[model samples]
Target chain A: MTLALTLDNASVLIFALTGALAASRAQLDVVGFIFFAALTAVGGGTLRDLLLDRDPVFWIADATPLAIATGAAVLVFFTAHLVESRLKWLIWLDAAALAIAVAAGVSVARSMEVGTGVVLVMGVATGTFGGLMRDVVANEVPLVLKQGELYVTAAVAGAGAALIASLLADGTIWTTVACIATTFGLRAGSLLFGWRLPVYKPRPPRA
Target chain B: MTLALTLDNASVLIFALTGALAASRAQLDVVGFIFFAALTAVGGGTLRDLLLDRDPVFWIADATPLAIATGAAVLVFFTAHLVESRLKWLIWLDAAALAIAVAAGVSVARSMEVGTGVVLVMGVATGTFGGLMRDVVANEVPLVLKQGELYVTAAVAGAGAALIASLLADGTIWTTVACIATTFGLRAGSLLFGWRLPVYKPRPPRA
Candidate 1:
């Protein structure tokens, strides 16, 4: 097994955990939680594959991610209370997951030589949109649309960093790692400090 | 407008209405209902386009479907009770929507000369998956998944019928119409006679 494969699997686990956490909070049954977990874990990759016109959609092609996601969901079902007990650590874990997803998406897109803009947008989408879909499916307002800690903005910035690294370095592993670190650091800081975006308000009525 | 264009636009309107109807039944706000309408209407086509690697993703390329969906959503918001108040008639209208969507999807798949298996799946997907997505997004159990009429099954059958019809004919308008009729008739019969798949009950506990 390689570092990339390890990170990929970890990313899938993180993705599954997000859904499992949300589902457990919603008090869904095991089946429901697993369904949401599966959707959250592979939903973005599936969309990416479909948009890329690739066959067998990645999750369907390799069952590893699905297996991991199902396992994560089951684990969360039994141990949700334990994880919830550690409320302070949850934000950092979420930030880690978001950063990893962004980095992974950027890596794959650049490897495929997709255009810069597509790469950036798709990376942000892959990182944040799965959770967005998860929240939407779970009947909650999407975090991206709300006044959250600039989660998607962080993803976009991370994606930009990855793109720059890819363009500058001659396929060096350090470059990729550096980009991932940049994204992860930004997200972790935002989460720890409760950072937020400026709110948009309607203009005052004319006299 | 060309016949193909008419069929395409009609399919969009029908599916959009189906989504609007579902959202209304859920008592979603106007914006929420409009979102559901657009998702239910264009979601299948958008997925299809993505799978085929078609650029602009359909709705983003053509403003007509989006505009049409918005208009339909507005119309449904004002007249939702008109449909929701009558459960039976609305079911038939939804069936009609399924019919049109299946027909349109089959026609487009033929134009692409996609593989038979993928085409069949895509046709059914284009017909009913949007509604499934809407139900998931609206945080409700999908009607098709419950003890309801065979919606997706009928859609698949209709799509298969259209493919076969296209093969037998010159992809004539009659073939499409016949396919649509097959879908609608089957769904209508299901509604009128309570035709449904057998429920999967848990096996009796071993003695």
Candidate 2:
């Protein structure tokens, strides 16, 4: 498989695991596990593809990623009992998935020769949308919208790094490496240290 | 505007109103009102357009619908206090929006010469996805996924009707009319009669 395809499938697998872990925490049935897992694995990329007008979608054209997502979801469903502190594992898995997703998204956009703005946006969307969808379906506030997390910022930095590297480098491998490293590094830093962005504080309503 | 555009705009307006009302109930600020409203109004159509590979999403290409949605949200934000029982109004508005959205979705797919199955899926997605997004953002279980609602089924029936009509008739007017009538009629009937589909009952977990 191509490097991009490999990165995409890896992202899908990890995201699917996170989704299934979420469903397990919510005590959702088997169907819900599968649905949420698949949704989280592909939701971001699906939105990006749609926005870019990529027909047949990446997964529809190559079902391998989807198969991996579904298979991972099922395995998580059966093996969740074996994992201790699933939430902690979920966070780490999600961070890794986010990095891979950002790399894959940036790679696709750069290859398509889309404008810089669109490429950056696609990268972030691909990295974050799936987790947002998973949280929403699980009836939790999306982590991206939560205060004091460097989630989207990390994606933006990673995507920007990818875009810059693509312009300077001869091949895409360097671009992917830069994108993944920036995203995963930022995310890991936030997880280990309490890194945060400035949050909006709502003013008290008038009497 | 053409009939399809009219239907799309109408859907956007009402869905935006419902989204704004939801934000009002959630005690969100003005920014939330606009965000939720725009998300609800265009969410479904955006997904459908993306899946169909239509470039420059309908609202993106023509800013009128987005303008209407944002305008309506702002208007509701200012005047929400004047309305009695916002939830009551929200339900009625959502039903109307669902019908219009279904019609618009079916119309687009039929015009694109897509298959009957795809047309139906797109119609349902267009009708229901906006509300789903709104509810998810509002941290409520999506009304469509809730037990016993005929929400999605209504869209399916309407889209199917449109597809059959499109095959038999010459103009899209007939297809649009059929779609709107079936969807609205079913939704209204459910409201008036408490009509519902069979609910899924989860089994108790083994000890």
Candidate 3:
């Protein structure tokens, strides 16, 4: 449980950094940075908790995550310009956050003993929805939905890896490691090596 | 309770229509229409429920709203082009939905006996977040955040009216009527006469 909580907090902080970077790119005020940071930090987990009917969402139950997100936002608001490539930083941080968050989501759902399909969905949602909300709110196309990008696909594969490991292995640790490794590996490959799935192309209408 | 349920369903249907209209304008597929319709129909209430920690969210407890939204989407998918001005129809339908939804939110929160401030927040959230999600997902600047628009202001004022009416009147019916009247009146004025609140403008940084 402690490990899960730590992972969750780490993901929140990392995602908040990405959100703040996006806000800086948009040239928003300090309050906007904090708002975006907190929203992106909690959005996915909130959605998951709501869907799972978990009581008093994580941030509401324990204010640490919110505080961390706020602190991250303030730090970024002052230092974002020092980063020469905010977009590159945002994408890499987002990838790392996605890996950790997917593991956390899988842990939560497996502990709850939900169906595998729901677990997979929750894991992917937890991994991607925060960034999706941040980008959408910032008026940029959601990174998860960008043509040929492997964001959601990587999340799904990672969650699937965790599920398989859970069935094959004896403990939660192995499952979590599997999830993070697969998620981060795929996302990193996509960023570093331009790995991508084929995008859909419209065909001519039937004659 | 029946009255509240009816109002909720009505708002869901109207909101779904507006969402479907948005999808049509975006030129998305039929599936996209259904997704947007259901999303807009339930987004606000879902957020309100999550915040209030309402068990078994409204749509989860009662699938009727989801069904109604899906039906609205299918109907609009076939007939949207028949409307000469989809934007005009979307805005008017959205305004009506906003009023009904605000009343429903106030009713739910009041029934829970929460504090007035939380009730008001729930009211505005339940009225506006659905359309906000719809616009965001469609990659359109959210109507609520449009420059000086009375959208959110109308919802807030309407919710505030309900609170005042609740203090003065003896029944929920009076509060509901006041909410709907104020919300619709302000929104209509905004559309018809360009009524708006002053927007914030940034000052130049000091030398």
Could you arrange the candidates by TM-score from highest to lowest?
A: 3, 2, 1
lDDT of 3 by residue, A157-198 (tens): 999999999999947589999999999999999888889888
How large is the i-RMS for each model, in angstroms?
A: 9.4, 6.1, 6.2
Comparing 2 and 3 on lDDT, the stronger one: 3
Best first by lDDT, ranked: 3, 2, 1
Query: Model 3, residue B147: displacement in angstroms?
Result: 8.5
lDDT tens per residue, model 1, B113-190: 456755665677677667668778766765454433567657867887887787788647877877898888878777
Per-residue lDDT value at A50 in model 3: 77
- Estimate the lDDT of model 3: 0.85
Model 1 chain B poorest 10 in a row by lDDT: B198-207
- Model 1 residue A150 CA deviation (Å) reads 2.8
Error of 2 at A32 (Å): 6.7
Q: How many backbone clashes does candidate 3 have?
A: 0
Q: Against the unseen true structure, what C-alpha lDDT does each candidate score?
A: 0.70, 0.83, 0.85
Q: Model 1, DockQ value?
A: 0.07
Task: Write the number of the candidate with greater lDDT, choosing between 1 and 3.
Answer: 3
Q: What is the alpha-carbon lDDT of model 2 when measured against the actual structure?
A: 0.83
- Which residue runs of candidate 3 sit more than 4 Å off their true CA positions? A197-207, B1-43, B50-128, B137-139, B143-207
lDDT of 2 by residue, A187-207 (tens): 888889977776888999999
Evaluated with TM-score, which candidate comes out highest? Answer: 3
Where's the lowest-lDDT run of ten residues in candidate 2 chain B?
A: B197-206
